[model samples]
Target chain A: MEENNENMTFENSSLAENTAVTAAAVENTENLNAAVENAPDTNAAMENSSAGSPAETDEEQKKPYRKIPKGLLWRCWFIFCFFQRTCQCFDRAYCNAFTYGIMPILRYLYKGREDEDEQIHAGLMRTRNYYLCEQSFSTVVFAIIIGMEEQKANGADISDELIMATKTSIMGPLSGLGDAIHGSTFRQIAIALTIPYCLEGSIVGALLMLIGMNITPWLTTLIGFPQGYKLGSEFVLKLLQSGKMQKAASAAGLMSMFIMGGMAAKYANITLSLTFKNDYKEIKIQDMLDNAIPGLLTIGAVFGFYGLIQKKVSTNKLILGTMAIGIALSACHAMGY
Target chain B: MSSTGITLLVAFILACYYGFYSTYPFMILMGPAGMGSIIGLIIGLIMGDPVKGIEVGALIQTMYMGVVGYGGVLPVDQFFACIIAIPLAISSGMSNESALALAAGFGALGVMIDTLWKTINTSVWTPYIDRACEKNQYRKIAKGAGLYPILTRMAISVPIITVLLFLGSTAVNWLMDNLPEWLQVGFNNMGTILPAMGFAMFVSYIGKKELIPFFIIGFYVMKFASLPIIGMAIFGAFIAWLVAKTDKSSDTEGGLA
Candidate 1:
């Protein structure tokens, strides 16, 4: 399973035109495209919308580019690229995509201002906004684009090992950081700060929510790029240098503190465990004991589910479990049990 | 009081005061059982072109959705931002599309206008939070650095979003309305669904399949049980800890933590 996943991952990560030695490279981008393109509801979008300029894609490599080793497969790349690029797609999709998506909208709104040209380096600002929205989870996107550049730099031979290694090894860690920083920490924390007002049905609340939501990720995404790229390059070089992944995971763990801490502050939830032996009785466990049980219960639920939760559990079920345990036991009166 | 400050305050008040009354988002999601979303693009283009603005709102919900507040420490201070922003946009002529987008930003912008309000808040409040975090260095940093940046962000954001919505929306509308036929179609198509797609991506990415139970628990608490999301969150955490304790002693240390 590990080997299969590794090979599959490597093949999925590789973006160069396909070659001879490792031809059946298990490209998953096509599957990913099919999953997205054939998404239950959102099919039949404009062909143009789902693809970039087809005219520009004619690089004319005779060798096929499939998981298959030998016969030419430009058609597959064309189809996926057409849909994926046109679709403006990505992985670790939510937080990164959200940041990427919003930057452009704000830029679009602001750039249209007649005096936007006068607003603090408009061209650079516009470029920043454009890149942010279009390329929020841009680690892979940029890597793929950079891989193309590497093709130019290294005489375009398509080193399967190098390409596969870079894509598989680098993508998970890069995206993990990407996911943690942008999605979990910055976006979650900021939005956590922001949403109460919007739900409250007040303009002030919405504004607070919006600013809290947008600016953090916007800033994080901007900062994340150089950090991720540098990290990726350094990680590969270090592996090359020492031939070990321990340092890489250690580095990632260190970076995770800031990200996870922020996530803890924002997304972490506690189930309140305040039940009265008798409601009429004036003595309350909370007022008397200062809610220690409830507090402990909160810590228990958050950290307990922490492992299961982080590995990508359905948020819906997590929430439901919280409520079931909350109400069921609150009625039963479990004091941080 | 100088008229400039008063004028700014009133405009801020007018723009954002309605957020307190806007229950539409809560109502929308709180209703449907399955994963449901407000059709932001339809709202944006149909209303104005605040595609980005609406996504901003969606992100706010998702980001905080996972927050588990133990004891009584409420993590976020800007819950009031969205309530303020949405209504102001609509009342001040922001279409539903644009209004939803600009609404949250406007709320924070409103808060920004009244620096006096925040200063009074932070000064009276900061010491308590500061003292609470003495045991943990991270909490200390959180109190000193983390909380205030967001507050300052809100302070500075009011006028910025206000101008963006009331004035900027017009320009955005013009561009969308006036673009060359094919280009306009392209922009409109991309503009509308792209934000929604972005939002769904966030959910799918972070909302992993295994954790569905927790999310469902949260939803259950929020929905059927009628417990406060905070209360349920705490209870959930407690049970999770007990579960962890049981899982431990006999097994390797691996749970939510």
Candidate 2:
């Protein structure tokens, strides 16, 4: 089994190496194409194009002279294109993906240095100890770090400590931002918009939910990547300090709560079928409860579970307890409780 | 299609969907709302009752609507539950409610599998990548980070899903045939109450002290007024906007509280 596993790893690594080589070739062709397009005249373009022989370009010029290459950014985005939850280890929550995604950019930045391999190794190891962030929303953090890496490689006197500290500090705010807007608010709204239609068996509703849930995350990644790289971390710090995000979060929280209330009333219907005989009327317990307060059972049940969750009772246990109680209640009702 | 072919096809779909959940495009389909509806639709179509399948799927989705697996920690695997429940409901002619109850249990099982996978990746793949980092082998690191997990995940999910689908159908059929009627009704009641837990989880998540009133107000208004949900959502957004504007004026006076 060990041998087979090793063999498979070897084959996979070879395949990945081939891809990397091809990617480098593709990037070179693109750069050359750009250089030709930008030249003032055809002769200058020919001279620029002929400045390097094909063999020399392959060996020596694979790494671009620019501080931050467009190809490297796209490569980072592609690496991030894979599910961010790909290989989560207990010790390092998301550091594996983080380090892996940034590898190409680091390689490009540190390419041709005195200790290129050593610098790459240090760069990977620096952030691999611990990382936890919202995958799509945290694209800004990745962009800022890549920007920092570029500066550091170009002799900007930036230390490894500063990079590490930036990562450690920025993740908390970004994760909170992501959790608030995307996780708590947009997700529920998407479901709210689609659930009614889906209940009617409309495929369009399902597709809408998919699109709605995804737009923000993808948009954040696409827009944040370039802006974060250009503006660096200060832009994010300014935005946070401006109190705009706070106000938005508050508004979103309010909207989420309101929508949640309506949804709970609409969907969280828990019917109590217990009824009793009275002197002059057939009294249904459900009717009495409804008369007192509309959707009272649903409201009570929601708050009850909310209290349990607040107490930090594991959701799994609550689900089981609910099922048990529900079954037991059904059995009692059958026995005319 | 033959039963074997159908089984293989469904098994393949589940495995691919579950295993490649984090991959591009598939990540969009990872949520309970998205996965449940699609899975329910597919299995329903297979059973020649597409609407019923969607109804079951929507029920599960509603029950799990508020569940956000933030930071990769699944509170319950609603998608896994749908996979188990929808097929059973469609194939064995079981009630949606009982199938939902059955799904609630399997959701826990899905979490266990996820935990086990994460643990294995921690002990095995993480160290392999660490060693590759030490050697400065980028290709090896990518393999450990990307390729290997998907393969191993497929290996783990395929057999589990296949076995569950084949055996689960029989088990549900037997339970339906032999279980007392009251217990079945109990399961249905449980399903009805399950959505309460979803809303409860959402309320707990978003319900700060100041924000709690909105939920109550939203509930009662929804109850009494009988307004469309979309219209209510717009009113909520407008009210929220007004609140923010007032709060901003207060913040200007009080200075960043």
Candidate 3:
């Protein structure tokens, strides 16, 4: 039985491969009118080629992508992209159950053989189990990859267990890498670029931020889907070992630091408004400070805040502390002391 | 509708958005609807004073730029903060500084409400999905997972926002009318100091000992050369590229050796 199934798989794959080639050929034919004219001939040829194949029934059953309508797939993408975080209740199973639970929609749409329900359930369970680990930025990528794997599996040869194992193994490294690249590195750079414009009340700045922030996740998910499908479990290791990801992140980090410094000087406002009476002259403290180092107070303020943060001061405490000092200084100023 | 009624209505809508009513995972990429700058712009448009709204929003935005909620932990509730602070600032003619100080306090309050809401959602709403899964009902499961949470979030957000907007405007007006001048000045002063605190928090998140020099360079170029932020960013990118190249070459040599 196993040998028969294997032979059937091989024949079906070869037939599908041929169809894909013909589809490509039809696409590559230049003129629009010529392509249109050739479409019926190509279809006839494809039907003739598949007609002699003994595994035609299997081929019909295996065309899961065709069975799974575009609208259903779109709905799957919508749920995977947006609502995967709905149930954060289970500790190890974070998004796993939610991701697994939604796969039935796609499976039902794929409309495999009547007896294939168990295979579908097993595939869904494996997907659910592998996605047990929690992730933020990479969750969408993981979902897309799993969806592609299910669609491609076609209920034979590629066991649910193998597919599940592939997904489970890659989750850890992908999560860590994604958090570093998307969460820490790219996000900071986006914030630095957008904040200045936001401060200026420029709609352009907000728009820029909206686009910059959304595009990364969107593009990553888009690129990750195909790469994950092609590479399977090897995708995570290839991505991490490539060293390019780290290099990009570090470069972004350095740029972010420079931008942060610029922001500090631009936004961290502190002025020494006090003027001192010196021998035969009135010296403005702020003027002297500016002469010695322009944006002197601004630099000091950033350093001071940095120092406080290094001391592990909580954000709320720092906020309250800053407020107290400001109020005290204002009171002093008001009293003319 | 009265301007206060209009403002509250807008605030309610924003609260629903922030409540993660629909496809919030995608919406989050828009950078948190509750962010001060965005909120300010929205409020500005609603109040018919986009310029002042942006100014106030910018000030508040600086305070929270370094703040991020990861692993279900939010240090402050900027959503609630902006809702209460912006309208009050606009109505009372409050300086940016005072508005910021008020936002910090209100944001902390928002954190509590957010905690309460999330607790209810996880404990109550999440189990419905598990039930649906056991029954093998795909449509039920999808609705339980997707649509149910949105409904719950709306339930939690709408009323709270309405009350805050209605009462907040009255309260801010009262404070403005009754408060002594010194206290008002104190709030104003606190605002100026708060931005430095914001920057400090930001530095802590992205600061590296090796990158300290870049920060210094950025400060000096901005102060001494009086370069705009865009110019500083360009220079920063150039330096980063040079550093990255050198680091790559050295690593390759090290690997070969």
The RMSD of every model to the true structure, in order and in angstroms, is 22.3, 12.4, 10.1
How displaced is residue A199 in candidate 1, in Å? 6.3
Model 2 misplacement above 4 A: A1-65, A278-281, A334-337, B1-6, B22-35, B38-53, B249-257
The candidate scoring highest on lDDT is 2
* Residue range A78-98, candidate 3, lDDT tens digits: 566566554443333345334
C-alpha RMSD over true interface residues, model 3? 4.0
| Error in Å for residue B81 of model 3 | 2.2
Q: What is each candidate's DockQ, to 2 decimals?
A: 0.03, 0.46, 0.38
Model 3 ranges off by over 4 Å: A1-71, A86-101, A104-106, A109-140, A143-153, A156-169, A272-297, A334-337, B1-11, B20-23, B32-34, B70-72, B252-257
DockQ of 3: 0.38
Candidate 2: residue B240 lDDT (0-100): 91
- Residue A75 deviation, candidate 1, in Å? 22
Off by over 4 Å in 1: A1-169, A192-282, A291-294, A300-316, A322-337, B1-257
Question: What's the lDDT for all of these models?
Answer: 0.33, 0.70, 0.61
Q: What ranking emerges by DockQ with the best candidate at the front?
A: 2, 3, 1
For model 3 the TM-score comes to 0.78
All candidates: TM-score of chain A:
0.37, 0.77, 0.63
